[model samples]
Target: MTTTSGNTNPASVQLSAQAFRDVIGRFASGVTVITTCSGGRNFGTTASAVTSLTDDPPMLLICLNKSSTSAHAIRESGTFAVNVLAEDHVQLAGRFASKLPDKFEGMAFEKDGNGSPLLVGAIAHLVCSVSEQVEAGTHYVFLARVEDAVAYPGHPLAYFRGAFGRMQMAPDASVLREVRERIITTVNEVDQAIDLDRWAAELAVGVDLVHRALIALVSEGLVRREAGQFVIAPVPESIIFESYTAKLAIELGVAESTVGRVSQGQLTQLRQYMEATFEFIKDDRFTDPEAWIQANERFHEYMVELAGSKILLDTYRRLGLPGLNARTINRSTYATAELLNDHRKLVEAYENKDLGAVVEVLREHADRPRQLRARERELFGRA
Candidate 1:
């Protein structure tokens, strides 16, 4: 291939190998271990440069470094199996990529139709016979005709930017947190029912993960399981009153503990969060209730963080006060201007290090949600 500069001579425009690898590393690829049996011994090496060439005759291609032992074995036997690694097979991928004398030592595998060793528990496997091999630079590009293929259900192992990783199917703590926050925001801020399947689809996570998160929320008293479906638990007037009461108690402690101790750095961070919240709330620019909920949470979380007590923060979080308040607020009835004004007062109180004023602002902030819930209860009667 000629460069765009019309340089047909390869030496005329030399590129550093590390630079080339770094650029191409941006293209993520699935991890695979190419295995072959020759002279009654199994040989394998981890590779990422594999692709399907066509479907008519089932052709695939794999590029192997010329110096690799697996490449020599494939040349000798003319057959190899491509074992696509799953997320759980990171150790196996490492073993194959190393210069271990026996890559498959004590490993469980089965022979394919072409007598090539296929790693057990791989996400997929492809048995192939080498149809053509062309030497290209320091690697050999082998064109193989697929003899057989098999696939199993699992997330694939991936390589990108010079590190091995996996596509996550099961929700991690971050995913669970996100799902939890969205559930509370939707149920309270948007005043909507929880839709498990819709949330799963929107978050690109398994339904099971969403179910697990809902179970956690249920334990936190933010949700309840009924008739094989998860829903927001009924908020009695007393419970709503108790929630705000708890918030005032907990947050007042936070403000008192952090009052004189808050550093300039913490204050600046809090100010930035308030600015973000103001920007979002201005002119009702935030169409999504979740965005507004997040900004509000950030502002409050910083206050709690400044309190510098893990036990206190944990206690506050376990109460699920934010979620409760979200459920209580009827956006249609509650004035955004009033809410913004509450936040403004709170920020000013913090800036002045006035503990009494901060406590007063938090009480008012806490009371609004209760009032909204009371209004809701008066109108709707009950859940």
Candidate 2:
């Protein structure tokens, strides 16, 4: 939208087109070229004005000039496919932007469920059914409901004004370590999503560091590369439970410190961990001893983080046998109701700040479970 009359405010002033272009070019945005075919004909063009609109009803918005032939076809047919371009598709980007009569000439592509033509080997692709078309000035903005999508692993292609750029991928170990350190700082210190460029600059590193970090995650199966975007793998419920139980055990010790000795800073961290662990799951009372074991694991993880004792956390981690056995027990045994009751008692003790109660509760919560399970097995004639 544009409103050009004159600068109305004392502080507001207009810049020349050259200066304006230079200023706007500083912004780096992902490049997406939308394509569609109806009645056996292909049409597409490069565009950068694309963004996510909503999640409830999977939507995205893209703007095109009303005069573009693709816009007419999209409006008439009510279907289009969005191809998210990677840095490697610079040639495709240039080819599509031209007024060539046969844009699809010798180009490889596939049709999705909606019968929409999608460019093959793209970073990612989405086939959508047009939902709404709004006329804004000289451009027609189309909001579409995503019908199907697929993504591949690679670096996203970026465009700034008229120039194309590729993401830096670092390979050096020291550079990667530095990048991770800066990433941690940004995540903890900032409330907003930290800009990757600014973060790298602050660390005196290149964008390669960020790229390498993503590559490492992808290689380890900790993340996925699709359509030129990096996606974090979902944490499994078992893992979540294990982490919580471990945290709770760590925090139990910290909670035992005298009231006055527990400084305001430590108290803040302790409460945060407790509240975070509490709200993680919808159900606090697990169904069985194994489920309880998982819950216990997650609960203790938060506790450990709040304990503020790196030595304790590291020493505990080094005892691989304990953790390995704990995990084995979680997957093999079915938890009983009594185990959950013990967990509730432990949390109550910690919340009350009763040092003796906390210690007693934790001891039983940890050691009594195996005892109870073994008693039940013996009674049932397992031995």
Question: How does model 2 score by TM-score?
Answer: 0.44
The backbone clash count of each candidate, in order, is: 2, 35
lDDT of each: 0.79, 0.64
What is the per-residue lDDT of model 1 for residues 61-171, given as tens digits with 9 covering 90 to 100?
999999999999999999999999998888888899999998887999999976788988999999999999999999999999998999998889989999989664444
Q: Which has the greatest TM-score?
A: 1
lDDT of 2 by residue, 27-139 (tens): 88888778877667778988888888997789999999987878887887789899999889998999888889988889888887766678887889988889999999999
Worst-scoring 10-residue span by lDDT in model 2 = 183-192
